[model samples]
Target: MPKIARINGPRAAFLRRFLPLLLDFDKGDKPTGQVTNEKRKEFYDCTTRALVLCFGYENTLGNDSPGDLWDTTYDEIPAANKMPKLPEPESIERDTVIKALTPVVHTWYKNRRTEANSPAGRAVLTQRQVERTVQAFAPLAPPPKALDVYQREFKQDYIDAFAALWAKKLEAAGTDEDALKVLKRQKGGKERAFAAMRWDQESDLKKKEVVQRCKDVYADVVKRHKSLWGSPHDALPNSRMWSAISFHRRSA
Candidate 1:
């Protein structure tokens, strides 16, 4: 074996303890960067970008968890190991995630919609379930009228969408089953664990459905936004109604 290249310092320490364990390699002979084959390497890139986008790795990596991942880091170079910088509002996959979520969010707040023009900044959602979904995405939600605001909201959604896209990608890539297993393991929790278990036992068709429906993204719903989302202007596009899949401008 050609000796594996290594990186040390804070980034090295970070690779060891992050959420998805697959991305958690840097000590062993094959550091997380050089994980055997190209597929896992692809997993590394996808997961890291998603992490930076979702957690704001730029701000969060060393503290409690991911806050905001930056374009650069001091202790350890984040872009090392072939990782790519996360794109912003213009990111197609990220935009797809937010757009897909917008319709559902509107439906959840329809009562509010009918009541008054609630400022997009307020908690807005009353129900616990909806509130939890919105809140659990903390350090990542605020009035998304500006690019900075739009950025915070997109982080978590961007991560989910990346996972959804990667699952399909891995399945299509052939028998590198290990990568899929690692991806599944990262979703640890009673609910997600149960879902992962069921996925393991289900038919291929069912698995596909779980991945698609669960991600809350539907190509059918988002196809409408292709024209607006394709380029990147518009600040989430549309004025009143949800003319797109993710977010439409509201009273700000």
Candidate 2:
């Protein structure tokens, strides 16, 4: 019979801590006696499954031995010693589903916007026309529950993607800086042109004056574009002249 080698220090400590949980060993008693063939097989199977679950199949590198899963070449256990606990399988599945669906939702939004702004679409830009256009492309949208979860989880990623698209549209229309300001008003950033105008720095009277000025500008733009802005199908009315504004406003 092959003699079981004595394991000491960190490897012994690790087995003491984790083996019980992995094998459902009795916690009150320390494992003892010469290791039997049956016990060895149980340990190998349990450890192999644990390693595969924690680091994934790729980490195994085609090795069936659980001991081969860790790189002994390193003085330490690579970064695995500091790695966070594995998330529950259900959480992993939920995250995977959300990641897979986000791009599809984004693509659907882009295509719907494109079709709605087409010349033919613009010719019949009524509420009914817009509803019909959206309904025709309804299949493009992800299921509402999935979309809600994705939007909640990846809000910043969605915003950045849309902002990049909006920036490209502005560039294509040859909009200048002054025209871009109207649309920039709705966007959030620390580096905006009016960022220096903080409420705390201004007197109450000055703040009121500034607010009034913004309202006046917004009113003028709406008045000028009233005819074109009649339906959601229309792009931001005079968007070229208004410049850098996004057509889709996500609700807060």
Candidate 3:
């Protein structure tokens, strides 16, 4: 079956900025995992897979509980105040993947810190980095609507898969929400009607650092990958990398 394609605007934006580090190009060796020159297909598979693992395929797919099929929809997720729980790994959790990949993520941040510590990451980030970050997140922001509070059922398998990519990030900087706010210099709105909201502080220096980090990463990715920019369809607005940016107004 063709699984549904559900896009989280903010998360898609996050992945566009950072997940590129995961793309290892070899002139001689063929690319493994998700890699393609056809950007749309590449993004669809990569973004969907990443989301399915992080958010859980079962929650997004599979049969609904009892006769509750009519109630299952994307809007039902936010109200539940659901923090993701990862599932068990099918294979050994190799330290090498973490060891190899973290440096790239850390370096992306470190480069920004070096340039200005004001933001604390590179001048720009890769597409993968940005999208993956957003995709990896379980929604922390309060729902815009009142009925969005109901919780959706999820299986443990998705939780573990999502964790495989997130545990290191959390350990390095507390929670993902905290890290994003600290690193991005952003804040949630004060809506009394929303029960799941959490308060975050934004320091002058931290805000600068967060913006700088994101900016730097964006700049870096552009510098390294020229192919990502091509015909009209290849720019930021239309790319899968931008899918998570809820505020983006580009038509598909």
Candidate lDDT scores, in order, read: 0.37, 0.37, 0.34
Ranking by TM-score: 3, 1, 2
**Higher-lDDT candidate of 2 and 3:** 2
> How much is the lDDT of residue 138 in candidate 2?
35
Show model 3 residue runs off by greater than 4 Å. 1-49, 53-58, 62-200, 224-252
1 versus 3: better lDDT goes to: 1
lDDT of 1 by residue, 171-247 (tens): 77577678666654453232234434444555767445445442332342233333333433443223112233334
lDDT by residue (tens digit), candidate 2, 1-252: 112223334333222333323223322254343444345344444433333332333322222333322322111222322322322553354344333333433343334335445776454245434443343333332222322222222233244445555566567647577657644544333222122323345466755555565455445545543434344356533333222133334322
Best-fitting candidate, measured by TM-score? 3
What's the lDDT for residue 173 in model 3?
72
TM-score of 1: 0.20
For model 3, where is the 10-residue window of minimal lDDT? 186-195
Query: Once superposed on the true structure, which residue ranges of model 1 sit more than 4 Å away at CA?
Result: 1-84, 87-91, 115-174, 187-252
